[model samples]
Target: MILLAAHGSPDRRAQALARGLRKGLERVLGVEVLLGFIEHQSPTLLESTLELGRRGGGVVRKRLL
Candidate 1:
């Protein structure tokens, strides 16, 4: 699994970009990919990391931007 940590934005364009990147990552990695926000969005790093840890049996990687 991969955790993508990004600075969240209220703008629709920014959210769309992030969503696209997340999709691309999921397609490329062939594993579960989780999206998270450092700010301005839900499912923050701490929450997502904990959830990923609970899922088990997968490597957790992060991409920050």
Candidate 2:
């Protein structure tokens, strides 16, 4: 599983771009990709972390942007 963590921006375009980039990465990597925002967005890092733990009860490798 891959978590695509981004800093939330007030500009919606930037957030949309992040989503699109995350989707592209998923397609290219062919892996589970989860998106989370550092702030100003839903499903923050802590939420994502808990969800990931529930899905897989072990270590989760993370990549941040």
Candidate 3:
């Protein structure tokens, strides 16, 4: 699993960019890609990490942008 940590933004374009990156990564990596926000969004970093841990044991990598 991969966790994409992005700065949350109220701007629609920024949000769309983040989502686009996630989708692109999902296609290229061929693994489950999840989104987490540092601020101003739901399913924060802590929440996403916890969910990953709950899913199972695996090496989870995180990318920040």
Candidate 4:
């Protein structure tokens, strides 16, 4: 599983970008990918990571900026 964390935005355009990235990662990794937020959005890093861990033990990578 891969966890992508970013500074979320209230702007629709920014959110769409984030969602696009998440989808791209999912396709590239061929595994479950989680989208998380550092601020605006919900399901933060901690929560996403925990959920990923609970699902199964696997690689957890984060792309944060």
Candidate 5:
């Protein structure tokens, strides 16, 4: 699983950019890329990580942007 960790933003434009990035990554990887924000968004970093961990053992690479 790929975990995209970001600082996040309250601005609409920035959020849009994040969405685009997630989509592009998912397309390239052919796997779901989950989004987790360090701040200013639902499903914080810890929450997302834990949820993914529950899916069983695997390497989760975090890409920050």
Candidate 6:
């Protein structure tokens, strides 16, 4: 499981862009991509990490860009 940690914004466009990027990454990487925000958004990084654990995903690898 890949946990994508992003610096979130209140702007809707930022949210849309994050989702779109996650989708594109999933397509290109052929892996499950989970989106999480560091701040100013829903599904915070910690929340996403916990959710990932619930999903039975192991050895989370995080990358921020």
Maximum-lDDT candidate? 6
What is the alpha-carbon lDDT for the whole of candidate 6? 0.82
Compared with the true structure, all predictions reach lDDT values of 0.77, 0.75, 0.78, 0.77, 0.77, 0.82
| Model 6 regions more than 4 Å off | 58-65
Q: Estimate, for each residue in 1-65, the C-alpha lDDT of model 4 and write its tens digit.
A: 77787788778788788889889888887977887787777778678878877888566565554
Off-target runs (Cα >4 Å) in candidate 1 are 57-65
For model 1 the TM-score comes to 0.79
Q: Name every residue pair that clashes in candidate 4.
A: none
Which digits, one per residue and each the tens of the lDDT, describe model 6 over residues 1-65? 68788888888987888889889988998988888888888799899989888998754555443
Candidate 3 on 1-65: residue-level lDDT in tens? 88787878878788788889989989998988888888877678788878878887345555555
Report the alpha-carbon TM-score of model 2 versus the true structure: 0.81
TM-score of each: 0.79, 0.81, 0.82, 0.78, 0.81, 0.80
| Model 5 spans > 4 angstroms off | 57-64
Of the two candidates 3 and 4, the one with more favorable lDDT, higher being better, is 3
Judged by TM-score, which candidate is best? 3
Better of 1 and 2 by TM-score: 2
The residue pairs in collision within model 2 are none
Pairs with backbone N, CA or C atoms under 3 Å apart (clashes), candidate 5: none
Please give the distance, in angstroms, between residue 9's alpha carbon in candidate 1 and its true position after superposition: 1.1
Clash count for candidate 3 is 0
Winner by lDDT between candidate 6 and candidate 2:
6
lDDT of 2 at 46: 79
Query: RMSD, model 6, all Cα superposed?
Result: 2.0
